[model samples]
Every structure is written in C-alpha cells, then in structure tokens.
Target: MKAMRFTPPGYGGRRRDPDEVKRDGWRKQGLLAVSLDDQRLTWPERELVRQLGERLYGARLDKTEDKR
Candidate 1:
C-alpha cells in the first residue's frame, strides 16, 4: 500500500488539490490504500472511506446521480 498523505479539512487555510481528491476517491474505490494517520481524519470522513470500500467490493456504485 502506498503511504499517501491524508490532509485534514481546512488545514493551514490551504485548499486541497482537486486532482489529489479525485485520486484519493479512486484509491478508496479500489481499497488499495489506507490513511497514513487516523488522527488526522474526522469520524465522518473515516466512516465515508469505510463505506466506500465496502461498496466497492460488494456492489456497483450508482452513477446516476453523479454528474462527474
């Protein structure tokens, strides 16, 4: 597993990289990545990742509502 940096929301007043966010979303769907540090993640964010991983392995994600 690659050790990707997990940037917390609103860190240092710096905006997150959109590309990085997209990459992380892809990685979560594959379940091939893990957070480098849990302490930096909020509870809901962690849960969202967990659910995404489960959905990725268990069922097809619904794309009907996703405009991207």
Candidate 2:
C-alpha cells in the first residue's frame, strides 16, 4: 500500500498537464461535483430527474427523496 504524505506549506492546488487557462478561469477551478438535489435546482428539473430515473431503471418502491 502507498503511504500518505503531508503537502508542503506553500503547496498550490491541482493543475492540468498543459495548464492552458480557459475563458473565465474554468481551468483553474478544476473539477467539481454537483448534486441533483442541490437547492439551486428548480421543481420542474427535480421532477424530470425522478421521471428519468424511473424510466431508465424502475419505479422507486418508497416515497423518500432518495430517488437516485
């Protein structure tokens, strides 16, 4: 197994191999994980996700918010 090492005091965040900056500095922001249940989502959008999930897999047996 690999061992974990502490980052140096002045370490910067992750960088791309080419490191070419995109418009509005998206490259510097790196990757981010957005959740479907985020409060920013509208009601219609959440409904769409629920419907799509049901069609792709099957109807959710329970009525909880954990649709996915």
Candidate 3:
C-alpha cells in the first residue's frame, strides 16, 4: 500500500509517513488501532484515522455477512 504523508501538529517540525504513524498507532491500540496519539488528536482527526484504518484493514463482519 502506498504510504500517506502528513505533518502532525508540532511533530518535530517535520512530516511523517503513514506507515510509521500507522504502525505506532497500531502498537498503541493493538489490532484495532487508529491515530498515533488519541489524546492529541481532535475528534474529526481521530475519526478520519479510524475510517482510514477500517478502509485499509477492512472492518470485521458478522457471521451472516459475506467475507468478500
């Protein structure tokens, strides 16, 4: 997957790649992860990250749902 590039607020005054951010975020939240730091993230930003993670990883489905 192509990594996303974004500059976190006051993040060493530099941009960070999505892979690094996602990895760190995942480590923080485990299998179900999102932003790098939840406390630092605004509600919309957190939601965006959550949606992104869902799109990338695919949200879990119930037994009645199709896997495909």
> Highest lDDT among the candidates is held by which one?
3
Residue-level lDDT tens digits of model 1 in 1-68? 88758767676566668657767878787524545246668888887877886877664347675543
lDDT per residue as tens, model 2, 1-68? 87658777547677644324432255456643333486777988878777777797687667756654
Error of 3 at 32 (Å): 14
lDDT of each: 0.66, 0.61, 0.72
For each candidate, what TM-score against the reference? 0.33, 0.38, 0.35
Candidate 3: residue pairs that collide: none
lDDT of 3 at 24: 78
Candidate 2 — worst ten consecutive residues by lDDT sum? Answer: 16-25
Show where candidate 1 strays beyond 4 Å: 1-32, 59-68
Candidate 3: tens digits of C-alpha lDDT, residues 1-68: 97659856666676778777778777887754444367878988887886887788777577799877
What is the lDDT, from 0 to 100, of the residue 2 in candidate 3? 75
Candidate 2 residue-wise lDDT at 65: 68
